[model samples]
Target: MTPHATYPATQFRIARPTHQLDAVVAFYTEGLGLPLLYRFEAHAGYRGAMIGLPGVGHHLEFTEHDDGAPCPAPSKDNLLVLYFPGRQELDVISRRLEDHGVRPVAPENPYWEKKGLTFEDPDGWRVVLFEGSFGGGGRST
Candidate 1:
């Protein structure tokens, strides 16, 4: 769908503040294997990184203010769910995450426990690597 036809925006960004900027960037970039699209330092006393697949119309922005950015995750249930085509695709990424010292955790929701692997990032935010299309006729939980 066109940007104007959707939410009146051309792109989408999920922005969050964290004290562990370096670790957070590494988790998404190195562990998850997402490309770092952009990075900035000392911009109005904030340093940040944007990471996601290029040309995907959406990306994640993580920022840290010079003063202090101790934004802890509010809940274990809040997650960033990434749906892969199948287990093979998800396993490939899972291996990389494991190689980087990331491990899957039991999801707070039992539905996810049956659907995919859930991992907590450095900032205590959860990420679920689901092995199916999100809105397609993949599998029921």
Candidate 2:
């Protein structure tokens, strides 16, 4: 089968359920320096936040069910990789995460160890801050 030359997804979000909504939001906003774009509370027994770089086409959504969100990270290798263009950004984010009491964890793969630093969120999901840009600058062409 062949792929479509151009698919049509105007915006994107990676959503996850978390029990610790506050810590999760802090991880993305304070630790990673992403802005909180939108948030809601007690809507259908849920509370959540969307965080990312403003004007970017994608963001992360973390939600909690009032009943209890027992979702856990599937594995250490499951990661949301963010590509950065320089080491300065990496250093700044690293310091911020450290100040927030979030320390980098060793990655499961050696390739990531060589190219980036990894950290786990409050719910154990891993996120990577790569030291260089991804193909086509991490944006869809």
Candidate 3:
């Protein structure tokens, strides 16, 4: 069966504002292991980055003011759940995050059933590193 492409987005971007852009970038790139797909400085007094693994069809982007002004507080309920292919990969990711001084947190919602480790970003937004998922195909962005 063919899936109808109603949305024009082949690439989906989730954007947020950060008070600590460097730390946030480090968390995604160094800690979470997402590749730094690109970085840009906008004339609108903010710069940002796009991060994701290759060929994922979707990525995360964030912007921050050069003045380091605080944005609105991040919601604890918002989450970015990333799925790795295997348990070993999850282990590796866990270690990387730990090396970056991140401690795992129990998710606000417990439906994950301990299948993954959850870490909060510098902005207090949550990201779940789970073991196994349908990796990036056959869906609209």
Candidate 4:
């Protein structure tokens, strides 16, 4: 199997410091419908949140320092691509996002619109929700 087709890490952690902890957490939990796996309550004056779907091998973590800046402005080019099983699942997620006041947006990349809808999170990060991979187990393209 190709390297991208294979599962390399047992557990993957992507840590990024965010100034908007509450807004960012709400975006993931409400807009994306991700579960809050766990939390660190200002661990050593650093607050953070980890979010991901169940049975996934990795999680997206957001952090902020208590003594750091009060507000965080996410980069424009920061993009996260997520794949859903089918249109049915995508529609359900869309409804969830709408309920949370997140509407579909046109991405800078035209391919995303052709594949699926996109949304800009509270922190200004982009989220592309597209169709799932043919071979499904854990990680996907």
Per lDDT, the best of the predicted structures is: 1
Q: Tens digits of per-residue lDDT for model 4 on 15-90?
A: 7777778888998997789999878885889989899879988999989898875555656556788888788888
User: Model 4 residue 29 lDDT?
Assistant: 92
Can you give the lDDT of residue 83 in candidate 3?
Answer: 80
**Candidate 3: count of backbone clashes, pairs at least 3 residues apart or interchain:** 0
Evaluation by TM-score, superior candidate among 1 and 3: 1
Q: Local distance difference test, per candidate? A: 0.89, 0.86, 0.83, 0.81
Candidate 3 residue lDDT tens string, 37-83 = 99998758989898987888888988888777667776766888888
Candidate 1 vs candidate 2: which has greater TM-score? 1
The lDDT of model 4 is: 0.81
Cα-lDDT of candidate 3: 0.83
Which stretches in model 1 have alpha-carbon errors above 4 Å? 1-6, 136-141
Residue 40 of candidate 2: its Cα lDDT?
98
Backbone clashes in model 3, listed as residue pairs: none
Looking at model 4, how many pairs of residues clash? 0
What is candidate 2's CA lDDT for residue 120?
Answer: 94
Alpha carbon lDDT of residue 73, candidate 1?
A: 62
Give me the overall lDDT of model 1.
0.89
